[model samples]
Target: MSTFIAAFLFLLVFFLLMSIGYLIKRKAVQGSCGGLGVLGIEKACDCDEPCDRRKAKDAKEKARQERLAQHRII
Candidate 1:
């Protein structure tokens, strides 16, 4: 039980230090290894033309935004 408590305290202090360092630097949190490019994906939407399903979803989102704008109080 004491050994477990010591290990937990060590890990807690280690992560606290890491968090403070990140806050000081304001660095973006990302994968430890290189981002998705390692898997050959340049981006989520790399295709020149979006697929029909994606197109429909985008259109729906656009329409929703337009409706919200029309009803916005300002």
Candidate 2:
């Protein structure tokens, strides 16, 4: 019984820490990598093509450039 209790406590703590890490990751990080790089497997997407985040960022940048061009007075 004591051993089971100890194991349960350890697992509980582990899961709690994992949950906190996931929350922090979701709130604090941006962008996704498609390769097995240093960040970790969790940060990597399994897609064969570009990820959605990069596509969105590229689209945003393009829109900003268009707006700037429109505002330019030359």
Candidate 3:
């Protein structure tokens, strides 16, 4: 029937538009959020070159140890 065909076409168009809208929204969200950061996304700093893993770890451990020693004195 003409009425049935019209209804089906309307629904098909509506759903197609909805799918396109959802895809656009998903892309927008991904663009804004980006990838995860260890500390936080807002405060994360992008370095020029990748950090030296061994030296960084050693420095962090030393700093932590110093903090612990200072706390023990208090």
Best by lDDT: 1
Best-to-worst order by lDDT is 1, 2, 3
State in Å the error of residue 5, model 2.
0.2
Superposed on all Cα atoms, model 1 deviates from the true structure by an RMSD in Å of 7.4
Better model by TM-score, 1 or 3?
1
lDDT of 3 by residue, 1-74 (tens): 99999999999999888789877664332444455554455423455454688559768989998997888633
**Cα-based TM-score, every candidate:** 0.53, 0.37, 0.35
Relative to the true structure, how large is the alpha-carbon lDDT of every model?
0.86, 0.75, 0.70
lDDT of 2 at 9: 100
In candidate 3, residue 55 scores what lDDT?
A: 58
Q: Which lDDT tens digits does candidate 2 get at residues 2-53?
A: 9999999999999898789877664443457545655465434545576789
Per-residue CA lDDT of model 1 for 1-74, tens digit only, reads 99999999999999999899888776656777877788888767778899999889889999998998899665
Candidate with best TM-score: 1
Q: Give candidate 2 misplaced runs (Cα > 4 Å).
A: 27-74
Q: Tell me the spans in candidate 3 whose CA falls farther than 4 Å from its real position.
A: 27-74
- List of clashing residue pairs for candidate 1: none
Task: Between candidates 1 and 2, name the one with more favorable lDDT.
Answer: 1
lDDT of 3: 0.70
